[model samples]
Target: MMFASIASVALERAQMTRALLLRMIQMAEMRDPEETGPHVNRVGSYSIEIFEKWGMKHGLSEEEIDKKRDILRMAAMLHDVGKVAVSDKILKKRGQLTEEEYETMKRHTVRGARLFLDKASDFGEMVSEMNHYHSDFDAMAAQVALNHHEKWNGRGYPGHVDIATGSPLKDYAVPDYPHKALGKKEEEIPLVGRIVALADVYDALSTKRSYKEAWDEAKVLDLIGKEAGSHFDPELVEIFFSCLPVLRSIQQRYKEPEMPSE
Candidate 1:
């Protein structure tokens, strides 16, 4: 094959990656109006900013930090992509989810992870070889999607299950969720997943939702501070606060466009 043909394939591969993320986001927005493009963009931005600082504190090299941060920016945006499979009734509900609905809702984490898991590894050489980090990218993205909902205290949903088959990866089942694997806690949750988890919730709390008003920064900080080792990764939480100004800049950069006056 001509060298030009090979280069064209590489370009197509990159475009394919972008297309996958954007298309999935579009589908999800159709189901849940709140998962807007801008919301995902802010979450991605927050994740990388906080993760970079955490990496520096932990002694990761600069190159390693950027690589992980770049992958994380794209992956974190898809953290809620699985909501595409949920019913409009559940996703659009303005009130509390019923017990069964909540169980169904919890499946989004695993389902989102499933979107990028096993199938991604089977890409034919024509596409697979186009990007050197193809396998690792998919794996990291899958893990982010899978575990972003997990808590530091192991109370997170759809935890520790095989992404491919939804079977328990381990025997850890919670009393409230006997049918599925329990979510991971603290060290068990991968740092990558932990980073996005913190980023996603920060955005959710600070951003206005159908049932809630946008909270001021002080209120957001209080709740996050109180949940340090229970809800969020404690150290990441510290890094987040340390770089509060930067995170606010990102939040402003992606703020929603105002509606036109009537």
Candidate 2:
């Protein structure tokens, strides 16, 4: 009975820590108010739905999938936390940025990763001493943030040298800034990262932004199908399609609140 009580208190404290971290992410996103919709919440829901379907089809036991689902869901929300470091002129721009500005914008992925990395470095020891589960979640969050921008065909940004070729930026010149490179592709990308990538893109396409109108559901699904093996993992994309009905329900439930017109 005493052990049970202690465990309950630990769980409550963990939940509080998670809530604090999520609020930090929200504050960072508030910097670019126009882009901050219900995106984080919607992406979290979408990722869990996709991960569940994909896990079941891939032969993962229900227990295994259930154990990691919440962590993955929470981590997905931090995928864009690095954008806080982006300049207002670039992040809030109403029009296309020049190549230079776009390059600067891409640094958000690295910056986001750095934020979690710093957290992991600072609190990792303390969390591990208290609860390994919390430490694991922090590490997973960092990984998802770092690799969410990676592509299946290896064309994604914050490029790293392919270990095989020893060439980091084969096509484009290296950026002036420092970045981490995982050199992951397809199944190589962490499942959590892959899930968040699809969720992120789906939410972005389905919602309206300052630069473009919201895309129709059919158009968005068609684009997902078209990019299955290139922009997304083919198998996960199949699972995503299978769960479209549920995905749509989540979309409706967390539908972005209408913005006031200027």
Candidate 3:
């Protein structure tokens, strides 16, 4: 009887934990229904599709592919959960933010990662993966998170540090801090992050954001493709564009309803 009771308690905790995860995901969605809607869900799905395609092309084992796909999906869902920590004024701002506000906005990645850490056990390894994956860090997942913002010529954010010299590739105004540390593993960027980088940018551009008009699918793809090696990983750009037809289908199917204005 004691054994059975313990098992029952464990099951209940598991259920409650699952419920909370779903609720939090929804809360994140509600935070900006107009902008978010089914956007994240589609991004998650797109990430999975890209992984599957790559895995098939490379002939990965069934189990290995499935495991990695699951990780990508979970990581993708929590990708923007950090935005939850940002103030609505910033998140829902009408126009471009001042440099100060932009800095505050960037902190969402750190804040969002911390939120997941609080519930790490429930998400298992995914909690750690998503947090670091989206940032410009030296960690393995940084390819998907941190370095995704990095340009091939080294004109991105966090440091605008060039990927080659570890400094900015171009000159505008700020000093280029080229000697900063390269990511954790300079050898292999998480394929998932490379994939998500494209998907996330595509989703943001395609969605009708509060501040800007949604770009058509073709336009978004063209811009991303053009930025290949500049704003995004070049190899992934070809892979990403190839999947556009399917991605558009996803957008059509899961189009999020606009939130009612109060």
The 10-residue segment with the lowest total lDDT in model 1:
118-127
Ranking, TM-score, top scorer first: 1, 2, 3
Flag regions of model 3 displaced more than 4 Å. 1-16, 33-35, 118-153, 159-189, 258-262
Query: Ranking by lDDT, best first?
Result: 1, 2, 3
lDDT of candidate 2 over 46-101, digit per residue (tens)? 99998888888889998988888878877887788778878998988889899999
lDDT of 1 by residue, 11-75 (tens): 88888877766777777777788998889999899989988898888899999987777678888
Give the RMSD in angstroms, all C-alphas superposed, for model 1: 2.6
lDDT for model 2: 0.77
Q: Estimate each model's TM-score.
A: 0.90, 0.85, 0.71
TM-score of 1: 0.90
At residue 238, give the lDDT of candidate 2: 91
Put down candidate 3 lDDT per residue, 2-105, tens digits, no spaces. Answer: 99997786666655654655676688877854435487688888888877777877889888787667556656765666677678888878888998899777
